[model samples]
Target: MREAVRKESEIFSELAEICTSPGYVHAIASLCYQNNILIYADKLTPEDMLQQFARDILVRTEVSTLIGLACKKQLNIDLPSPEVIQRYIDKTDSLLKEIHQSMMLPMEYIFDSNEVSDHNFNPFRDGLVLREPIFYSGESAYYFQYRDLSKIKYEKDNDWFLRNKGFSIQQVIDVVMSIQSLQNDKAKNVLRGLFDKNPSEWTVLSAYKFTAKEVSDISNIEIDTVRLVIESFVSSIGMDEFNSLDDFNPKNAYPIIQLPEDEYLLFQIYSLTQALYETPFFWFNDDKAYKNIANQHRGEFTENFSAERLKLVFGEERVFSNIDIYNSKDQVGEIDVLVVFADRAIILQAKSKKLTITSRKGNDNSLQSDFKKAIQEAYDQAYLCATLLNDKKYKLVDKSGKELNINREYKEIYPFCVISEHYPALSFQARQFLKFQETKNIKPPFVMDVFLLDVMTEMLQSPLHFLSYVNRRTSYGDKILSTHELTILSYHLKQNLWIDNKYAMMQIEDEICVDLDLAMLTRRDGAPGSDTPEGILTKYKGTVFDQIIRNIDKLEHSEIISLGFTLLSMSSNAIEMINNGISELIKRGRKDGQHHDLTLEISEGGLGLTIHCNDDHESISRPRLENHCELRKYTQKARSWFGICIGQKVPRLRFGVNKEYDWVQSNEMDELVQDLPKPQNLEGKNKINFAPATRQSKKVGRNEKCPCGSGKKYKKCCLKQEWRM
Candidate 1:
């Protein structure tokens, strides 16, 4: 989107001028505090103001973060000239463009929507989709997919940085507990508040510029310890200290300014936040062995934290950690975290590796290597575990050396690679450098830092809602490009994150994550999002559909996971169509004085649902639902079928039947279905209305021959007033 402005000298000179100014550090630090921490995440400001300020604050952070590294002098954004400001804006547009061009054309993608049902665990990573793109020497043409990523968010959650730049929550506890003086819970919170405050307005910067004694007096920590902690967090530098991006490492970084009479002050808002978080780790680093232990603990904490997070999404009973696979007593591979739900599961492998310092400075080779360790290798382990699990000949065991009981036939396994730290440029790095194994019957893994995972489990609490994300993410992630994982997730939460097959590419802007950031921040404040995730289940919140979703894992049957998947796999329109059909069935049942049921198949032989309606709870019976669902399954030749029993009076779901899968042709069953009422025409009941993303006057490709039989590009042939319609 931007012309490459290669005048590095002019750009750096302008940036240096602004960064070296007296107010640049304080200005950004203040913006970071107000835009992020001051108000509740839910929009308290006017919409236009919020959007504009979000963009402005984002600009401030990128520019300020760059200069904050070594700019010990006061800094401000008052540029030497308008040309300098224009040049800075141009560079940012280039980064935005880079975020959008993240798609690679794979040779093929075969989505087997007829997924397996409960208790039938098939151990493969669902590798039918290719993760690696084929090298094509010849020319190729691609279409443009539509997405809006114009949203902006300026901060990572403060809690994320608290964990030593990369440790998980439990490790956070251990790390903070070990370093009592600096990072213990109260000290950490108070330390940041010492420098930052949420004022009524942002017109005047309101952060405290205080001495060590004033800070200690304001906080609960003892004055002597507070001085030592501040000293440990000291990270000021001379003009020569930084020359490139690589010099900025949060572990040893925070912008500060030297005041009068030999006193130095922390950049109040975000800089102090960084200093506060990174101080604890530095405090323990005085002991080499302790530091080493802490380092190893990082990986362990990631694994445990991932398992805990997964447990939150899919119940604790189904989530297993450190499950070892064996080939006749010889340990083969281990699953860091395995979450099972009937016939579907998610396999996760966590890595503590982060983006190397050199990588952050713009070294391509270092970036690739860092990604390989932090994301690719984790996927490899998870994929291997999935493949082995698919092989019935292998054995599974837990970390306790006991044989792990994994009897269900898992038909679809979503593999995930989780990182210990929030690696910047993560989404782009994945698209650019990650090389997935070319295999069959497996899906591409989604790599994310623990920060996103934590938010995901919190927002999408229902099992089906969470599973729907995995299903959609694995299906369309490669084709969609964005700057952050949260950006993509935020779009999904807002609008289901769907891309129509009509387009070949989609570019998601950063703008969509703004509301999500507010929601997440509100959730952090304990109000839990005045406007959190508004995804697939939002419309059906208290309906029986919602009840089914809430009880997906709670159902006493083995096929609940698959049923949840089947229900979630349907479009929102499809769900509404089913609801309409259920109403019709209820009316028909009242007229006929019998329990009336309907079967709504989402696709020809994909996932389908059978809903039985009755006037009262007494009229609801498992055998009746089971009979109707089984007959429907046999007739439709469906891969998976679920039965829901609804009591008309209660206007709610009374109970449900577990999903049935793996249909077999039987003459007797065929005869039985024939004796039943003839199947109704599915036109109205099965119709799913999903609008086209974009409508053009010319339906043909811009490069393809025109539809009017003119052998010219559609754009050229259709260049007329009538075509505009």
Candidate 2:
């Protein structure tokens, strides 16, 4: 038998194509007219279909606009009228909302409890770190370390820098004022004097050197308040909060140690200051300390996010994240996310790089370099991980480095690079590169832009459909192997079994088991006396019968006979039920007697059933007909009974009765008798006549013929007409 084919999403692909065709649009319009739905058919032209609808449809326009904006305003398109655009935008937004509501996964939200710790930098113990020198010119009155104060003024110019560092302009002002309010009158006056001299010329360490007593003498404020104010100002700059004025010295000071809240505020100030002082700050800079940290966190977030999305789409059991694969040679690789289906594996590599179109014309050298590097790195890592999976000897481990034992082995692996940002030109280039790689026999990873990933998570609910889409997009080879076939292959590979022999044996066993189970269910005598074994067997002759007969040599004879008997027992019970329901026929078989001669026997490479009786001829033959008819009626309701006999011959025989008991004859009986071998003579014959009695000495009437079909009159023959009534 030919194997069942795997289901494909060809219809969806075809629909996608048809949706873009002008002819299809026209046909749809025609359908609307036929249905009496008014449409502006005359206004619909090939150009209108291609330009007006194709390019300007609500969903397409909204998606394109999003992509364009994401790519740093690189994409250029003609704008439609505001009214028309707004209408489409609203429609698109509504559709998206509906889709999201329908497809969102029902996952329980979990709260993270890890606290954000403080980070601080000090010029003294932490070393004077200058991101870039504020001034490189000849020496001035202020020392180089004091120039760090220049950052404070620069922070006021860069709002975005502050926001990125987790702060607001108001928060910054509040923190500064809070520190100022802690200072006493004398300390405040000293601060004012320092600012007037040159706010950018004084370092925190230098301010710490001025004694509170000197400040108190200068401003005539309380000495204790001055000391408290000086200590508050020092602590604000990330100094030891409990340090004594006598122990503190500008020459030997502690490193800046920021408290959790203070660290966050200071980092914001420092970042904003750097941004404002620099000539230009590249948004996509790879070297910045904060950017590097952000990228690490973002990459982790992307992996987790992708895993969750996959879990929603495919279920949690099928998705594994941060899987580590290592060979004996110590070559190691990690998969960001692995989605395993019954027969396919999807390996995802999440890249946190911010992709942008540096050149509108798509010829920017730096953009091309960055895109290629990212794609290549992701692909190489994915390929390495896939290679490990291809061999059963190497196991893929979870994040904790514990081996994962997946029951199913994949026939196909789809590697995808999921990017954080949209870069249309780079994406197109990546696709072309992948296509080129395919020619070289390397299955390159597909580039999944964030938008496309979102859409796929919504659309491909089934893993089979997801794999089908991947195959179509990549021009992968035809999907000829079934899930069962792949399962067998997996077993063979894992067990190191001979492929040809084991696969064939497994296939045969599978077929036999399936056919046997189906036959049993349909032919069994269960409640609802609606079906019979014989009818079911006959219906499945071409399919189930052919399979059994072809593989009979491989199957055990006892097994087949057991199945046949099981079917017979069920059928017999069902027949008895039907007999009870019939008012005309009394059932011959009894529970107490154990004399049911109904036998299901294997003969001549087929199954046949025989029934016997030792009663009067009429009682035996008439009941046979009733039983046959009743069984046939129930069997008619059955599904299939391919290997069992349901013909008229199997039910017509009578054993242990004399030839005189042959009172009924039909063409069906003749055909059945001709097919069977010669019957054995009975060992003990006790024939009892059951014909209705007649008056033995009745006088013959003149015109009546013999009752036995003789030509002579009743007086001439041994018949009496008066006996008929």
Best by lDDT: 1
lDDT of 2 by residue, 1-725 (tens): 32332222232223233333322222222221222111224332222223222322322212222221222211122233334334433443444343323222222211112321323321211101110010111111111111132233223434544444343333333333232232223233444565665533322212212344454555455556544333322222222221211112211111112222222111111222222222112332433755555445446655766777677667888899988776764647888999876546788998756433332222345444566566767877777777667677666778786888884355567788876443433333453333223322235466664435644454344443344445534442222122122122222212211222223322211221222222222333121221222333233345422232323222323223323222222332333332222211113322122122232222222323333322333433333434332232222222211122111222212221111111244454443334223211111222211223233355446666433222335453332322322
Number of the top TM-score candidate: 1
Error of 2 at 462 (Å): 2.1
Q: Which 10 successive residues of model 2 have the least lDDT summed? A: 126-135
After superposing candidate 2 on the true structure, give the runs of residues whose Cα lies further than 4 Å from its correct spot.
Answer: 1-287, 355-361, 364-367, 435-444, 476-725
**Residue range 1-725, candidate 1, lDDT tens digits:** 43344343344445555455444444444434444344324444323225533544443334444445325454342323334433444554454233222222222212233544434422122211111121101101000000000000101222433443443233322222223222223323543554464432222222433455555555545556544444544554345645433355442344344444534444333334433333444444665756676556566767877888788877778899888888887888989888887667788998867555566544546656777888888888888888887787788888777876765466678888887554655655666566676345467787776667877887787677787787877778678876567777778887776776787778777677666665654555333444565566477767656766666556634555556666665567666676666666555555555555565665667556667677533332555566667777787777767777776655566677755568899987776566444334333455533222232343567776433222334565443313543
TM-score of each: 0.69, 0.31
User: Could you tell me how far off, in angstroms, the CA of residue 2 lies in candidate 1 after the best superposition?
Assistant: 8.4
Listed per candidate, the RMSD to the true structure in angstroms reads: 16.6, 30.4
